[model samples]
Target chain A: MGKYYKTTPWVIPELPQSLKNIFKKNGKKISIRKNQVISGNDETALFSNTEKLIYIDSGLLGQAYKTYCVNKPYAMSIVLPGRMVNYLHYLEIDNSGDIILALRKSDIFTMTKSQFDGITEKDLKDEMVRYCKKAVTSDFDAMCCMFTCDTPQRLAYFLKALAESFYDDISTMPLVEIPLKLSYAEMSYIMHTTIRTIERLLPKWRSMGYISTRRNSLIIYK
Target chain B: MGKYYKTTPWVIPELPQSLKNIFKKNGKKISIRKNQVISGNDETALFSNTEKLIYIDSGLLGQAYKTYCVNKPYAMSIVLPGRMVNYLHYLEIDNSGDIILALRKSDIFTMTKSQFDGITEKDLKDEMVRYCKKAVTSDFDAMCCMFTCDTPQRLAYFLKALAESFYDDISTMPLVEIPLKLSYAEMSYIMHTTIRTIERLLPKWRSMGYISTRRNSLIIYK
Candidate 1:
């Protein structure tokens, strides 16, 4: 396995008093084990209350997917830390049946929708809107990449996106290490390709000195 | 062309006073020709002012896409009337170079972000959030369909979605007519399949009585 190392947690510079108050009043921080189902299953809806949001405080990777059969499911998108999860449920959007899965150990905070609405600061709301937009736009970009880019390019793009999510200052990072454990099948599913395709391309990428396999993680050189 | 016909527009049951005031203040309704570019490109940003939102009042079809080269572009999502467009830009989401195209003639209304914010009513903001969530979830569902479903099933799903966008009560409509002109190449691009695949499957779908071609439009039976 890749060496397990603790990285410094990302910190928000400042929060408006209104938002801080919401977090203080309604937020409940919870720790999730790797490969845990954060939300969405027969047992529980993503937001059982439908009036709350799950804020990812720290994590490397997460996934949202829909289960068709008990054994067959398709991943929709990879989730990153520092973004609100299940905001859609709070908004009362019909997801058409989807669930959130934690790809790694993660820290998340849950707060009620009423608490979120109490924050009247425009800047804070604007920032939340920006994050939502980024989440949607990133999903759109991933779809675009799947359709337009070649397999190799698509893989590279996915890696770069994952790396960017972890480190905001991507330029200074010489090597981007994805701390999550991803099997070939999982990678294939996320990239919309077959495991065979991933196996074929990884060797070529390794030969090109673009990426290296370290235990369960993939390391991309900058 | 499929018989050109007019349909009654969908009506919002009630609007909050704050929302109504926003519509009165910043809303400007404009008519666009068929195949118009509503946002993005050198001519337009998704939202020229991060402080504006586009509300699709009446339209059959619209498309949001990203252009990579002169000839290579990826269709991001299909736009439907009665939904808000460019809401993402108002939230300050970078679309990473995506543009919106009207697949058919459309009527749209534009409003300023400040005007939108003036609507302090929780219900109004909740409604907006619901729309945003639906937009993102729909895109994610499309991605899932593209990855897991077969081409014919995928095409059927797309057609059903398009039809649902037009008719709110889809079950009541015996025949769902898609007024948009989509060549096989366009369908291929949107479905992430080859033109040959679309051509091959379309005839099969026609023979199976799932859909019928009327000029360039598709008429699907319920």
Candidate 2:
């Protein structure tokens, strides 16, 4: 299981800026500051508006789902820049689905299904499909890790995934120092464990010379 | 967590035999016997041809993936009739992806992506997309259970899910005894625990007046 835990997710290329720029221009671009929470609920609309397809252009979006015991919900997973958050549907009036919070100062844009469907141009639609397919594969890999690997193995798998998400072609490069600019608290959220537990395991990994932590970021040698 | 573990998956209506019959007519139907393993490999084909959308019409299909220490691959989860298996992609020529086994005498049909995408008629395409969306939500619920719940909670969740999968509208009836036709061995495989552990747990549930085993099947009272 030594090399099995080292399983890295398939590399996903960043969505082309040209296509994303069109979304930014045509749709709503919401900027969320680090550590800020975006409640799905709006005061005027009694229902949580989940009608938009979200594109993460920058920073991290942590999806916090409520647990029975914990007073504060922890993030079960993360979405990095170039990742798309789609395909989740919650009950119509219920407030219990996902609470999207910015793990970092993030910028995200939303496109409605109608807007997506209205694109009659074949070329643009084909390009969009290609990008969406990439996101789907990334989702599949993350999900495979979630279902199959042990917890520590899951953490290791995701750290490498997060690094690769940040750097487009980090997987192809020779042994190099890749800076993973995510905090331990965020890592805790991702792993669904306490920050203290992450602290214990991370240093054990560092002592074993498998990885290193630098200040707020991690130096992941791939 | 008591009420929480009683979490029943939202009822999925059996794919209308009307629609499924259409799939059966257009695609190749393969019958797999109980306990029979279908290696993706054919004698001559060097590559595992995963280029099909499998629609299960009846019986159970258990997907087993090899673990590091185990000599026999244990099923991680199950696919009941009305469940559609899509969106998994294995590496080309790699035999390490999935080992599909019939948990019962199962009949499944496959439709190529080309066959799926070739439907240009608006009404038929719309119906197929709606059915596909329903399948996606079922996948989502199952995934949420996997990621968020504890082991016992997950087991409880899946048992209710399995019962509902076997009988449509099982969720609607009050205090009904729903028959779950899966065996303890299959339950052990699904939970990634030993059959001994399942034997230990089921009797405890029985003592608590929660469930009862009848021959090889289970009677789940909801």
Candidate 3:
């Protein structure tokens, strides 16, 4: 599974500059350290009770969805810099168990429902709809790919997507390589497999000169 | 598996009347027979080069997602009346292999991109965004449930969902029973399993006095 992320050419997108500009101009910004859990579906995720537009300034934010059969949740989405965390929550169509934690120290902005509504020009709203729906659609596609793809293909995609999430720019071309905001346990959790599976795959990939380890992140050399 | 829909309480929603009002008042309506394939990601799904908003007027619509491992596409969404199909395509974010077909003789309306933009009031756009995001989120959750739930539970959810999709109103309560838009082969396709499995489950469920056949649809008796 670890090897699959290397071979997969799938690239996750960064938030677009236009949308970023809207947030920067009107949204309140804040920062949080790594491992902090930013959640919803109980009390408000933000200090405010209104719906919000969240812009990730930096760092990795992870979300997972669980089903009845498995005790573990499958990694649903990974938010990198320049994107909002929960558009559905903001839109108020549904509220989900947020449980998205900052994998690294993260900088983010929160624009309340009023602020977002005030800035809701038709063009911007159109763009937001496009981005949010695409986020949900492709994220589901990725999950489908993850569970159904062979271990090798799954690992390749997971790594490529992980590396791609670091940049503020969204692209589709294959990346050269990057990782650190992951541990073996986290990898198993994100991949929705067992720690034993992650442990078994890491050594083989490491010996094959496919990946390396730093302080906390796994760097793909391949 | 066949009995699960009877045991578990899961209900699919029909399209809302408000949305239906918007489509009925402003969009062009057309009808297609059962099994008609309505597609995207290739030649235009609509005659116009521009994107269009689709509102199902009547009958069931089926969409499936395929991954690398499985040869079959998983039952992704079953679209009922009043709601729009492929909002991402309408919004032009990403295009998928529009494999959604009319499961029954479906009457639907097509509102062009320009038409949509023209009618895009702020409140309406917000509602649209909310609806689309919720559709994607819960639909993905449904897939997660399908793949992860035990066979009995899996079949239960599948059948209840199948029945609920026939109506235009979306609900979450458990359904009493209904069926007929499904064949065992189609059941295998939607459930992402073998026909043999469908064959194996039907009789056991029948003997248990759970389901019976009408002219076309299966009627569930809880």
Model 1's DockQ? 0.28
Q: lDDT per residue, candidate 3, A109-137, as tens digits? A: 87876677676787887777667655655
Each model's fnat? 0.31, 0.15, 0.49
What DockQ do you compute for every candidate structure? Answer: 0.28, 0.28, 0.37
Ranked by lDDT, the better of candidates 1 and 2 is 1
**Which 10 successive residues of model 1 chain A have the least lDDT summed?**
A1-10
Which candidate wins on lDDT? Answer: 3
Give TM-scores for every candidate, taking all chains together and pairing residue i with residue i: 0.72, 0.79, 0.76
- lDDT per residue for candidate 2 within A91-177, as digits (tens), equals 111224556667789888877656865853677666666665554444444545555566687677777766655554675765445
Provide the TM-score of chain B versus the true chain B for each model in turn: 0.72, 0.72, 0.77
lDDT of 1 by residue, B1-222 (tens): 011111111111122345445565568877777766666653743344253567766664444455352355555455556566665564455543545666668877777666676755777777665555445555556655655567776677677766765565677777988776677876786776678899898888789887888875789976
What interface RMSD do all candidates show, one decimal each? 7.7, 7.4, 3.9
The candidate scoring highest on TM-score is: 2
Pick out the ten consecutive residues of candidate 2 chain A with the lowest summed lDDT.
Answer: A87-96
List where candidate 2 sits over 4 angstroms from the true fold: A1-13, A39-49, A65-74, A87-96, A116-120, A168-175, B1-13, B38-49, B64-75, B82-84, B87-99, B116-121, B167-175
- TM-score for candidate 1 (chain B): 0.72
- Model 3 residue A22 CA deviation in Å: 6.0
DockQ (C-alpha) of model 3? 0.37
The lDDT for every candidate, in the order shown, is: 0.59, 0.59, 0.61
